[model samples]
Target: MTTTAPASGAHAAGSAAPGDEPLLEISDLDITFTTSTGHVNAVRGANLTVYPGQTVAIVGESGSGKSTTAMSIARLLPPNGKVTGGTIRFGGKDITKVRNREILALRGSEIGLVPQDPMSNLNPLWKVGFQIREALAANGVAQGAQAKRRTVALLEEAGLPDAERRAGQYPHEYSGGMRQRALIAMGLAARPRLLIADEPTSALDVTVQQQILDHLDTLTGELGTAVLLITHDLGLAAERAQHLVVMYKGQVVESGPALELLQKPQHPYTRRLIAAAPSLASRRLVSVKERAEVVEQARTTAHAEAPATTGSIPRSASDTIVSVEGLTKVFPIRGSVPWKSTPFTAVDDVSFDLRRGTTTAIVGESGSGKSTVAQMVLKLLEPTSGRVLFEGRDITEIKGRDLLALRRRVQPIFQNPYGTLDPTFSIYRTIEEPLRLHGIGNAKSREAKVRDLLEKVSLPASMLQRYPNELSGGQRQRIAIARALALDPEVVVCDEAVSALDVLVQAQVLQLLNDLQAQLGLSYIFITHDLAVVRQIADHTLVMERGRVVEQGDTETVFHSPQQEYTKRLLGAIPGGSIPLAGSETIEVEVDTELGVDAEAEEIAERDGARSPLGEEPTDPFTGAGHV
Candidate 1:
C-alpha cells in the first residue's frame, strides 16, 4: 500500500497530510551485532514508517529481523547490537544519532515500547503502582498522588479489573494476562505519539489476547496514535494491522495492505503460513493410510472419529487421570498494618475431571486463575485447601517419586518456546532425555526413536543436531511435543501449547496432537482460554472463572448452548463467534505413486518413521493404506 495519501484523508510517504506529517519515519535501516564469533547482521536494509494514526505490521518467523528492526528504531537493541546504517526520524528528529540521555526522554513520551514478555519488564519487589507512575514521571506527566491517580485511570482504561486494588499489588501477584494489561497501561501511561509492540500478546491466553487487542484498538482509535505491531501471527496481524510487511531472514519478501496480502500472498512462505493456520473445524484423528490418491489429499481431508461413548463413567473403576475437588489457592494481603487480614483467593474452589482418552480445555479471561490451576496441578503450589486426585489417588499428600511420576505423565508445553525449550540442548537430546530417563530405550534405540519422534511432529531428523535457537517457532514446538511424547505418558498437559504459535503453525501442531492422541490413545488436559481450540479438540469442556468451574459439559453442549452467563461471555469473546461446523474447503491435489493395497501399511511406516511398539519400527508413514 502506498504510504502517501490525498488531502482529505491523505498522507505522504515520509510525511502525513497537512497538519499530520506522520508520527515516525524510517529508511534503509541496518542493525548489526558484534558477537565474539564476528559480526551478525540481525537487521539488513529495512524500510518502514508509522503514520499519524495508522497501524503497520511486520510479520516473520523468529530471527527474521522483525524484532531487531523495531528495537533499533526504538534504540532498545541488546548491548552487543548497534544501528550500523539507517536513519530513524521520529517527529522529525533523527533517533539513530540522538544522545543516549535524550533518547530516554524521547522514549515513553514521543514513542513508547511494549516488549514481548511483560513479565520481564516488571520487577516483583516493586509495586505495579510505582512502575506505572515511573513512566509518567519520567516524561514529566505527573508525580506522587497525581501520577498514581492517572496510572489507576490508565489501568481502568485498559480494562483491568479492580484497578485501584490491583495497582497496590506487585507484578508476581498478577496472572500472565493481567501483567500484560498492566504493561500496556505503563506503555500508554505517557500517552506517546507512537507505540511499538513486539509480540505484546505472545505469552497470553487466547481470550486475553483478544481482549488486549480490542483494548489496543479502542485506545489507539481514541488517541489517534500510530502503532507498529511486530508479530509472527499472520492471522493476528491481519486483524489488527492495516498494512503488512513480510520479512524473511533479513529482508522484506512482500509488502501490501493486510487483507490484500493475506487473501493472496505473493511469497511461497506466506502462502504456506496462511494455508497452515488452524481452523475452527474438528480435526481428523485417524492416520492409517488406505490408498495413494486419498493419501495425497489427506492433509486437508482426514477426519478422526469420535471416542467411544458407551457406558456411564464408573464412579471408581473408570480411569480418571486427574481430579480437583474444591481446590483454592489464596494469598494473604500483607501490609504495614499489623491487624490487616485481607486475602485474595486467586484460584477459588476449582474442580474438574480429566479422563484418560479425551481432551478437556479450560477457557477464561485474564486473572481467571486458569494457569494457577495448572501450577496447582503441577504441584508447584500448595493448595490452600482441597484435594487433587491423580489416577484415583490423592497427590497432595504424595511427594518425591510420586510427584515425579505425576510430572512425567502430565507434561506441560509453555507459550514461549524461546524460554520453554532449553536453548543448550539439541532437538534430539531434548526429545531423548525423557525417553532415556523414563527407561523407554537405550542410546542407539533412543537416538533412532528420537528421529522417529521428530517425524511424528512433522520435523526432519536432520534438525536433531540443531539447538533450540536454530529452529523456527513451529519447529521448537514440535520438538517440545516430541519431548513430551517421548515417555509415552498416559496424559499430556498442554498448557497454552499452541498459544504463541502463528495460525498455520498452530493448526499443524493441533493436527499433530490429534493424530498422536488417536494413534496412542493419549489423553490431554488442554488448558487454554481459546474457545475455538476447545471446540476443535476438547471432547469435554470446563469453563473456568476466578478459579472456579463456572460450567462443565460435553464440548458440543458448551459451544452450542451454554447454561452459565460466564460461559456465554467466553463463547461470545471468540473472534468470529459460533460459525457453523458443517462446511468444507476445496483444493486440488496430484499424486505420483500408486501403491498396492498390501504395501500401504509398510509404506506409511517407512515414510513417517513411526515406531510400532517398544522395539519394532513401522513401515513408511505415508503408505496408501492409512488414507482410505
Candidate 2:
C-alpha cells in the first residue's frame, strides 16, 4: 500500500487528479458489538468508495448500520464494538489494523467527524471556542493566539452569527442549530481529507441547514475534501450527493448515482425511503395558482354572506377550538450583577385560531417563538400579555381542578421521546401513568385501555413489557402518541414530533396522526421548523420570525404565495424541494372549486411579485426528470 505525507493544512482545490487514488475505500467490512445479551453484528459485508472532492451519502433507517459504518471509518466506535473483519483503506493504506499513535495522527488532520447530537458530543463545561481550539491544538495545526483566531473563523464559516461572542459561550447557551454549526466548524478546522457528517443538519432549521450545507460545499470544494454523509433524509441525499448507498439490515443493499437510484431504486428499502420522503411531498400539494384560486373563491363566497369578514381573518368562533389572542411571552436574561437583567420577548402578538379537527402548524427557526406559543397553548408557560382560549374559555388563570380538567382535554407530544419518557418505566406503565393521574379507570380496565391504545398506534401488545431503551426512535414516538391519547384529549400539541425519525417511520407516524384526527375529531397544534413536514400534516401555516408572526394563512396558500421574504426563503431552503421526483411532474391537481378565480390569483401574484413556490421546474435533479 502507498502512503502520502500528512496534510499540514487544507488541500488546494483540485489537488488530486481525476484518476488519483480513492481517498477512502471500504471492502467487505464487518462490525460487531458485544452486548450483555450477546454478540450483535452491526455491519456485514459493507463496501463503499469515496474519491477526493466527491460526496457520497449512506441512507438508511435506525439500526441500518449507516452510522456504525461511518463511525468505523474514524475508529470512533464504542468500546464494545470491534471491526471483526474486512479492510478499510485510506490513502492506499489499510487502516483497520492501524496503531493507536498512527490513528491519533490521522484523526483531525486526515479524517474529521461531525457527529450527530451536538449537545452530547460537545462538552457542556467548556466554552465553545475552547473546545474548537483544543481540536486545532491536538492536531498540531495551531495553538495559543493563532488557534483562538482560527476557532472564531471556523465558527463563522460554519454559519454561526456573532462568532466572536458566541465562541465564549457554553454549549447550553447556544441553541441546537448553533451547537451543530459549532461542531461542523471544529470538524473542518483541520481540513481533513474526508469529513464524516452523521446527520449534521438533522436538528437545524431549513434556512440554517441550507447555509451550513452550502458552507460545507464551499470549504470542501476549496480543500478537495471527500465527504461520507450518513443521513436518513433521502431528499438531502438526493440533492447533495453524487452517489447514494442504501444500507439495510447491516448490509449495503444497493449503491449507484443518487438521482438514478431515487428514480429507479432496486432495493425495497430504497424504494420505500423515496416514497416516504416528506421533501418530495410538495408534488402532492396543490399548486400556488390552484390554492390562491381556492382561497379567492372561498373569500368571495364568504364575502357574499358576511360583508365584514376578510380572508386573513381567523375562522369564526363557531368552529374554532383553540384561539390564541395576541399571545406574548417575556423572559428575563439575568446579567452578572444581581438584579440586573434584560427582558427577552419570545412570542410577540402571535394570534391564530385552530379550527376543529384540523392541524395548525407554527413554523419557524429556533428562537422564532414557535415553541413559546405552543407552551402558552399547552398552559406550560405563562404569557405576559394576551390569552389562550380553549372552547371559548380563557385558560391563563385556571388552577386546581379546572387545570386538571384542561390537562385531561389537552396533551402534548414533545420532540425527543427519549428525553420525556422515563427509562425506568415499562411501555405499559408509561402509557398507564396518564390514565392513573386522571383517575379514569381501575387498574384492570386501565390495562385494557393501554392495550387498546397500543393497537391504535399499531404497536404490538408484546411491546408492553419493553423499556424505552429497547424501542426504536419511531416506536418511542408512537408510545408518546399513545400516552398523549390516553386522556382522549380534544387537542394535541406536537412539538417537532416526527423530526428525528427516519422518513419511512415519519410517514407512518404522520399517517397515524391523520387517522386519529379523522376518527376522534382531534385538533393539532404542530410546532416545527420543517416546511416539508408542514406540507404533509398542517392545514394552516403560521410563519414566525424573531418573536412575531410574519405571515399566516391556509398551508397551501402560505406555502405557494408567501408574502414575506423570510417565508419564501424557508420554502426555498427545503431539502429536495427543487428536486423533481419521478412521476411527480405529470401529476395534475384537479380543482373542483369555483372557476374565474384564477384571474384574481394572477392579479395577487402580480401585486405581490411572488416567486414560484417550488422555485424552478419540477424536475428530479437526481433522475434528470423533465419539468412539470
Candidate 3:
C-alpha cells in the first residue's frame, strides 16, 4: 500500500491516461475545528488523489475523518471548521484559496456532491423535479421550460420510472430510495467533472443500494466524471471502487487497488475491519439434519463425554413461542375527496413461527412489508385479519391490563436510538420508566434493575446519569437495548436495530443481542433489509416483497438455495459477495459471539476505560457456535 504523492506543474489539456493527471487531489491536508473546549484536529496530513474517470473510495469507521476530507474538497466544511494546511488541487490548480464567488461558480458546473441522508438533503416543500430544475438554474445550465425538460430527463437517467409523474411529488411522498435517486439526478444535473458522494447509499436497502450505485457508475462512466466516494462499508468500497483508500484517526493507513488491499490488508485496523464485516462472513446455512448427524457422531466418538451440540437445532412445534396466522394489514390512500379512497394492502397473509430462544429475521427492501409485519407482531398495529398467538394466546383482542401485560412480555428496540430515547431524560430514568410504567418493583429495586440492565448490555452503570445526546451512537443503542430488557421481556422485536450503526458497532450490538438472548431465553423478531446481518444473527429467515412472503426457511436454505427470483436478487445485491475475502476458509461463527468478538472493538473499549463483551480470548470473527 502506498500514499498518493502530490503532483506538480501546470494543468494538461485534452484527455489524459489513467493515473496520468489527477482530477481531484488533496495533499498534506489539515483540517481543524475550534470548539469552546479547545481546537480539534478533524483531519491531519491526509492525502488522497482521484484520477479522471475513476472511482476512488475512502473507507473508515464513523468520525475517522473520511467525510471531513471529502467535504473540504467542495469547501463545504461547517463554520467552526477550516482547512489549516496543505493544498486541494482540482485539475492541477489549488482551490483552497479560491474566493467564495469562484467556488460558487466552480460548484455544480465543475464539481457536484451527493450527500448522505437524502431526506435531510432534499426540501420537503419543493417538488422533486423543481429541486433538480433549481440546481440546473443555479448552475446556469438552463432555466424555465428548458430546465423543466432537463429535470425530467435527469430523473429518468437516474433510473426513476414514470419520471414525469414523479416530478410533481415532494420528497416525503417518495420512498427513501427514490429520494436518493432524485439527489443523484440533481448532483449530475450540471454534468460536473467530479462528483463527491458521502455515504450515499448508507441508509438504503441492499437492492436499492445496488441500483443507486449502478446508476451512479453508469452515468459517471458515460460522462467521464471522477468520483470521490466516502463510506464506512469496506465491502461496498471494495466492490464499487477501482482503488481503495483506508483512513483512520486522521490519516490514510492504506491505499491500493481495491481487490489487492481487501484480500491482503497490511494494517491491523484494516484487517480488523475485514474480520468484523458481516458481508465477508459465511452465507451458507448447514442443514439441520447434517448438523444433527455431526453432533451425534461427535457424541458417540466421545464415549460417555457430554453430548456434542449442533448450532441452532430446529425446535419442535410445541416450542413455538410466537405464531402469526394469516396476518394482513391494509391502509386507505385518500385523495382530495375525503369519502373516497383506494385500499392499499401493506401486509398480505404473512405467517411464520418464532421458536423459543431463537432469532427469526424478516428481510426486504423499503415498503416491502417487513416493518409492517414487525409492527403487527409487536401489537403496535391492528391487523386487518388473522391472529398473533403469543404462547398459544391470541394477543389481538387483548386490552387494558391484559394488553399492558402483553406489552411487558413483548418489547421493542427501534432503529434510531437517539429518536427513541427521550433527550431530556437521563439513562436511569429512561430504563427505570419502563419498570415504573409496568409497576415491576419499588424505587430502590428499579434503580438496581437499571444498573443490572446496563451491565447486561455491556455498558457501565456510570452511563445512568447521562442524557441521550451525551453518548455516541453505539452507546445510545446499547442504552436502548438495556431499556428494552428492563421489563424482562420474553420476546424482543428489533426493527432494523443495527442497520444505522457502523460495521464495527453493528457487530458489537448484534453480539450483545445474541448474548442477551442466550442468557434470558428470549425470542427475537429481527426486521432488517441487511442480508449480511441476517446471515450472522438469524437462525430462520423470511423473505418479503410487495406485501407478501415470497420465501421462508432456515437462514442457510434461503441463502444457499432460494426458490424466488426476488430472494435471489436480494442475495446477489449484497456487496462484496463476489470479492474474495482475506480468509477464504469458512468458520462457524457462533451465535453468541457473532460481531461482538471483534478484537479492535475490545482494544478500543479497554483504551477508552470501558469494556467489550470480549469473553474467552476473541474467537475468529468468522466462526459460529451453536445456539444453546
TM-score of each: 0.71, 0.84, 0.87
- lDDT (CA) per prediction: 0.70, 0.80, 0.79
Residue 587 local lDDT, model 1: 22
Give every collision pair in model 2: 259-622, 580-619, 580-620
RMSD to the native, candidate 1? 9.6
What does candidate 2 score on TM?
0.84
For TM-score, candidate 1 versus 2, the one ahead is 2
Error of 2 at 49 (Å): 0.7
lDDT of 3 at 143: 100
**Residue 526 lDDT, candidate 3, scale 0-100:** 95
| Candidate 3 displacement at residue 438 in angstroms | 1.7
- lDDT by residue (57-151, candidate 1, tens digit) is 88887678999888887788899999999888888878899789888887898788888997787988999988889888888999998998998
> Residue 532 deviation, candidate 3, in Å?
1.1
Candidate 2 lDDT over residue span 559-591, tens digit each: 769999999999999898777657765533232
Residue-level lDDT for 425 in candidate 2:
68
Model 3 lDDT per residue over 515-621, tens place? 67656667789999988888777889999999999999998889889999999999999988888754456433333334332343355445555322222121222
